[model samples]
Target: MRERLFAAAERVLAREGAAGLTNRAVTEEAGLAKGLLYSHFADLDDFVAQLVLDRFEAIAAEVAGLPERAGSGEVRENLTGAALALLGTNGPAVAAAALSRSAVAERVRQAWEGGAPGPGAVEEAMARYVEAEQRLGRMAAEVDGAMLALAITGTVHHLRMHGSALPDDNPELVRRLVAALVTVP
Candidate 1:
C-alpha cells in the first residue's frame, strides 16, 4: 500500500508538478480506496512529505552506486558521469514539492546527515575526486575537495533545472563538465 502510494506520488510529481497534486489524485492514480491515503498518511501534507523523503533516498542510492573511479586516468569522466546521473533525474517537481513543506525539508536534512547521498552525495564524490586528483597531481595539495564538490554539484543542479531538453540519462554534458573542472590549465 505504501508502495502504491509512492508510485502514485512519483507519477503525479513527474507529470503534474507539486502544485497539481492532491490526495484525490494520488488515490485515483493508485487505484486504491480514497481512505487508504488518509489511513497511511495523516493528511495531504504527510503524503507529500513522505514522497519527498522517498525521492531523496532514491537519488542517494543512485549516487552511492556510481562506480568508484579512484586512481583512474579519466577522473573527470567518472566524476561528471556520477554528478550528471544524480542531478539529471526528473526533479523539478520534486524540488517544488519539497519547497512547499518544512517536513520535507527536515526529512531531506536528516537523510543528508545520515549520508544518504542526495545532496551530500556530491560532496562525498568530490572528496573522492579531489583525492584522486591529488594522487594524480592534478589539483593543488591544499585544495578544498568538499568546496569544489559543492560548487560542481550546484552548477550541475542549476544546469539540470535550466539547460536544454537533452535526454536526462545521457552523460555528455556531465562528461564535458567533469573534463572542464579537473583539467589542469
Candidate 2:
C-alpha cells in the first residue's frame, strides 16, 4: 500500500505537475483507503521527503549496472549508459520535486554539496571509470573524478529542469555531456 502510494505520487507528478499533488489525489489514484497514507506517513511533508529519497534510490538502482562492466570499452559505455538512464527517469522528477517540494530542494542541495553519502551515483560511476582509465593509462593521474561527477550530474539535472523544448524521451544531450565530462585526457 505504501509502495502504491508512492507510485501514485510519481504518476501524478509526471502527469499533472507537482502543484497538482495531494494526499487525497494520491490515495484516489492508488485505489487505497485514505487512511493508508496517514498510516504510512506522518503528513504530506513526510511523504514528500520519503518520495524525494525514494527517487534517488531509484536512480541509484537504474545505474547500478555501471560497476559490473568488465570488458573492453565497458567503462565508457557504463558511464554514458548510466548517465542517460539517470537523466531519462529520475532527472526530471528530481527537478520538478525541487521546485514543488522544499524538502526535495534541501535534500538536493545537501547531496550536491557532498553532504550526502558516498559522492552520489555519478561520482561513484565516475570513480569506477576513472580507475579503469588510469589502469589503461588513458587518463592523467591528476584527474578529479569526483569533481567531474558533480559537474555532469549538475548539468543533467539543470538541463532536465529546462528541457521541455528538447525531444521527448531523448537522452542524446545527457550522453554527450557525460561523454565529454568523463573523457580521458
- Model 2 is weakest, by summed lDDT over 10 consecutive residues, at 110-119
What's the C-alpha lDDT at position 9 in model 2? Answer: 85
- Candidate 1 per-residue lDDT, tens place, 64-179, comes to 64435565656666677667656646555666777667776676667667755466665675677677677667667776777768777877766644544765534666666666
In Å, residue 157's CA in model 2 sits off its true spot by: 2.1
lDDT tens digits by residue: candidate 2, 1-185: 76788889888877777787888888989998877899988878778767766666666776655545534564556667766655666456545756677765675566656644222765577667666666667766677866766787677656656564654644777667766765555
- In order, the Cα lDDT scores of the candidates are 0.69, 0.67
